[model samples]
Target: MIDLAKVDYQVILLPPSGGKINITDLIDAWTHEEMEDQISAKVTLSLKNVKREDGWMHQHVFLDKRLVLEATDGNGWREIFRGSVKAWKTDSENHTVHVVAYDPNYNITISKEHYYFKGGKTAAASIKEIASEQGIPIGVIDGPNKPLTKKLYKNSIANTMMERLKESERKGSGKYIIRSTKGKLSCLKEGNNSVIYELDDWTTESSSDERSIEKLITKVKIYGNSKGDARPKVEAVKTGKTEFGTTQEILYKSDFDNMKAANEAAAEILKEDGKPEINRPLIHPDIPWIRKGDKVRVNSGTINTMCIVKSVSRDMHSKKMMLQLKE
Candidate 1:
C-alpha cells in the first residue's frame, strides 16, 4: 500500500516565446486533505500562447474522476476533464507540469510543471482516458503488469471464440467447436467420429477439416508502401484458451494493469501527513564572511538541517552573501 500523504501534484507555467524564465521558480499553491476512500479534487489550469488549430493533447494523472485536474489551452481555454464526482483528491507538494507553446508557423516552446511524490511516481497517461476506457474506478492498480480481468462484452465474443481454439491446442485436445447462430464450426482429428460433438448456438468452433482457418485467423501480416520505414515481419502466438467439451485458443493480450497500479501507488504516496524524503539544493551557498545578523544551519546534510542567511555584500565584485554557522 502507498502512503497517499506523500504524493504531490502541480501545474507548471512557461513564459511566452522569447521570454526568459526558470521553471523551478514557480510555487505550488494547492494543498491536499487527509486520506479518504472517496474524494474529488479539481484544479483549473489555464495557459496562454497555445496553438489553436492543433487538437487537444491530454496528460494522464493517476487518480479518480473526481480527483482529476482540468486544464485548458489555446484560445478561449476549454475544460478537458470532467465526468463522475466520485474520485480521490490530489496531494499537496511542489510539482512540475509540462507546457508547450506553439506559434502560427508551428514553432513550439516547451516548459515543465514541478510537483512532488511520496512512495513512487504516477502513470504517464491522464486519468480521464484511463477511466473512460477501462471502466473501472481510478487508483485501482499502482504497479506494472497488474492484470485486470474485465468481463467480456457482446462485441468481444469473436475474440473469445478464437482464444478458446488456441487453448484447446495447448491442452492437447487438438480440436474444438464453435457454434453460432449462423452455422456449425468445428475442428476435429482425422477419423475421430467418436469425439464428434454438437455445436452450440451463438458460438464458433474448430475442426480438422478447416485447420487452415486457424492459420488465417491467427496470422498477422505487416504491410507498407516504401521500404525505408516499411513494416517488418513479426509473429505472435495466441495465449488465451477456453474449454467447452473440447478446447479452443484465442489471441488475447493482457491489459495494462501495471499502469493503473503505478497510478494508485502515486496517489497513495501523495497523501497528506506523509513526509517523503526529497533531494533539494540549498537556497544559499556556504561561504566564510563576517556579517552581523546572518542565519546559518549546522553541517548536518539531513532534510531537517538548520540553515540561515543574512545580509551580504551587494557590490558587483563581491556578489556573495554573508552567513553565520550554527550548531
Candidate 2:
C-alpha cells in the first residue's frame, strides 16, 4: 500500500556468464517506457561523470548485453525491465554517460524472414515455432486450441509474430497477448478471473470513462467457400441495428459453409462486438508490478466491474501511472 511513496531505483549490468554489477551509485537519472503499441520496452539511464571511452559501462557493456532496471519502496526490489543494450552515448561536456536499451523485441523487429507453416498449427505453437527458429527463448504460451492452417508470413519477426497471434481469437479463448518479458517470449490468454488485482480507493487517485463506437457492428454478412460473384449463402438471425443506423461486418469463414453454423457464428460475433466499447482510464499510484493483459477490478460510486488492462504509462521518478482498462 505504498501511495506516493519515496521510490528508489537502480540500474544493473548483467554479465554474460552470471552475476550482476550494481550501477545505481553511478546513475544520475533514468526513465522507462513500455506499451503494447511499441515493438519493444525501453530503459534509458544517465551515468554521472563516467569516462567517455574507457568507463566501467563502455568496457563491459556491448550490444546485446543485458541491462536490468528495478525499483523499491523499502518493501524490497522489484524488477521493472530487462533488455539488451542497443546503443549509448557519452556526453563529455555534461559529464554523463547516456545508455539506451530495449527488450529482445528490438532484435526481432529488425529481422526479415519468410515463414511457411504447412498446416494444423495452434496459435501458440505457430508463434513458438517462429520464435524458436529466430533463436528467442520461449516462456508460457497459453492460447486457444484452435488448429490453424497454412500460415505463410514474410515480414519482420515482430510483425509476423503478432500476425500469428491473431489466430488465437475465438469463442472459447476470448483474447491472447503476444508479449516478450525478461528475454522470453510468451503468448498468454487475456483477462484471468483468478488473478484479479484491485485498484482500490487507497492507491487509485482518480478515474474517468469514455465511449468508442468503432467496433460496433449491427449485421454480419457471412460468405461460404463459393466462387466469385456468389451471394451470401447464410444470414445472421439479427440484422443491422436500425436504431443506430447500419454498420455491417462481412464474415468470411470457409468452414462456415453450413447455413445453421454460419448464422450461429455470425450472431455470436455480433453479440460479442456489437456494443459500444467503454474505455476507462484510471490514475493509480505507480506500481510497476501491474502489467498489460492483467485483469483488475474497480468499484467506485456507480462503477463496479472487472476490466482487462489494455495499457499502462508509468513515470519512474514521480511514482504516478495512468492505467487504461478495457470493457
Candidate 3:
C-alpha cells in the first residue's frame, strides 16, 4: 500500500559530461508520460519553483542532458522514466525551471529509403532490426513467432514498421505491442498477469462516460495487391443492423497477395473498427508502476472491468496520479 502522506520521489539529472545529480530535494517536478503504439514514449518533467543557484541556467542544461524520475512507496524505488532532455524553460520570477525529455527512440527519425522484409521475418525481429539501425536500446519482445509474408516498406521507415506490427494487433491473433519502458523499447505480447487497482470511496476522484454512437461499421472492404494478383479485394461483414443505419468501411492495402491474407485483413479491420468505443480513464493512484499500455483491473461501484492504461500524469511533489484509461 502507498502512504499518500509520505510518498517520496527521486529525480536525477544526468549531464552530458556523465555524472549524475540527485535533484529530488532541490526541485519540485511533475512528470507526465505516455506509451502509444509505434510512436516513441513521451515524458515531460516540469521542475517548479527550483531555486536559482550559481552555474545553473536554461542554456547550461542544454538539449543534451538526460533526466531520470523515480518513485518509492513501501517497496524500493523504481525508475519510471529515463530520457534525454529535449527542451527547457526558466521562470525568472519564481526561480524555477521546466524540463522536457523523451525516449531515445524519439531521436530516431526515419529517412527516405527503400526497405523490404522477407516473408519469414517475425514482427519482433523486424522491430529489433529497425531499432538497432537507429542505435536505440531495446528490451525483450514477448510475442509469438508469427512470420509475415514478404512486405515492401516505403515512406517513413519507423511508421512502416509500426504499421506491420499493428497488423498483428488488429487481427487479434496476438496482442503484440511495441512500447518503451524507461527508455528501453520492447514488443510485448498480451499477458494474463495484470495490475489490479481497486478504487475506494476515499481514493482521489473517479469519473466515467458512456455514449451511444450514431455511426457504426458492420462491414469492411479490404483492397490488396500481391505479386501474382495485381489487385485483390476482400469484404468481411458482421450481421448487425444499428438503429441509425448499416455502414461499411473500406480498408486499402498494397501488401496482401492472396485471398486468405486479404480476407484476414478485412476481418481484422472490421473487428477492430466495427464496434462502439469506450472512454474510461485510469484510476489514479500514487503507484509509480502504472504506465501506458499496462492493463489494470479496476473495481469501482457498478464498474468492475479491466482497462488498458492510456496515459499517466503525476505530481512528484504531491504524489498524485492522473490516470487515462483506454478500452
Candidate 4:
C-alpha cells in the first residue's frame, strides 16, 4: 500500500480562461509510475478551517472525476461526501494533481484543477461548489440521503427485515415457514401467527402439514444477537449389562431424544456377543435352551449335573458355548 502521507504533489487550478479542467490528466499524474494503467488513487486534500459558501471546509480524495473520499467540518463529520475514483492524471510538468468527482446526481466534474507543491499558490474555493462545478457529486458523508442503486437498496432492506425476523425467532416470538410452488421453494415467516410457512406454488398451497414456523427456521441462525456457538449439550449414557451382569438403564433429565438414541445403540451392542466363541451359549434342537437366571441339567464329556447359565459367549470363529456350573 502506498502511504498517502508520503506521496508528494502540487495542487493547481485552471486559469479562468482555460476550458473545463480535464480530470483524467490529474489521475494520470498520481498513479503514473506506480500503476501500469490509469488507476484510482486515494488522494486526500486537507483544507484546514477554510470555510466555503456551502458552510464547510472540505478534505477530499478523488479517483478520476469520482469522489472516493471526502469530509467536511460543517456537518461535524456527520455530513460528508462520497463518490468513486475513476482515474487520475497529472499536468505536463507533473507538479499538479488533477482529480475528477462524480456526484450522486450522476454529474461528472473536474473538481480540483491544479494542486501546487507550495501551499499558498493554490486557489481557495468551496470544495462543494468546486465539486458541483466540476460535476463532482456532493453528498453527506454519513447522512441518510446517501445514494444507492435500486437493487442495492432493495437487497439492503430485505436483509434488514430478515435480520429483524431472526431476532424475533430467537426470542420465540416468530417461526419459520417454507412454501413451494411448481417445485420451487421459498421459506418465510408470518409475524401475526408467529408461525413459518412452506408454501407449494406462489398460491399458498402447502404439500406438507403446517409445521411450527420455528421448525423451518434455519437450525442455526446467523448474523444476530443469537450469533454465538450455542450447541446442544449431550451426555454419554451407559448401556448394556452392568459389571454385575444386570441390564442397565439411564434416566436423562434433559435430552430425552438423546436418551432414546443411546438405548437403541446399547441394544445393538448387546446383540453382538462380548465373549469368545467357545464360551457362547449353544443352540440345540433336542436340549431345552436355558436363559439367564435359569437352572438346567447338562451332560457333556463326563460332566453331568445341574448348572445355572452364568453367561454366554461367541467369537469370530462362530463357536458357541455356555458357562455351566463352575467346578
Task: Single out the weakest 10-residue window by summed lDDT for candidate 1.
Answer: 102-111
Write the number of the candidate with greater TM-score, choosing between 1 and 2.
2
Top lDDT model? 2
Local distance difference test, candidate 2: 0.71
Question: Against the hidden reference, what TM-scores do the models get?
Answer: 0.14, 0.81, 0.83, 0.15
Q: How well does candidate 1 score on lDDT at residue 130?
A: 29
lDDT of 2 by residue, 94-178 (tens): 7677888988767888889998866566767777777788888888788756655565788987787676655435323467776
The TM-score leader among the candidates is 3
Q: After superposition, how far is residue 265 of candidate 4 from its true place, in Å?
A: 84
Per-prediction tally of clashes: 65, 0, 2, 52
Q: Write the per-residue lDDT of candidate 1 for residues 79-128, one digit (tens) a residue.
A: 22222222223322423333222111111001122222122222212222
TM-score preference between candidates 1 and 3, better one: 3
Q: Candidate 3 on 176-244: residue-level lDDT in tens?
A: 556677678877664333555555546746657454454567676665444575655444333343545
- Flag regions of model 4 displaced more than 4 Å: 1-75, 92-94, 107-327
- How far off is model 2, as Cα RMSD? 3.6
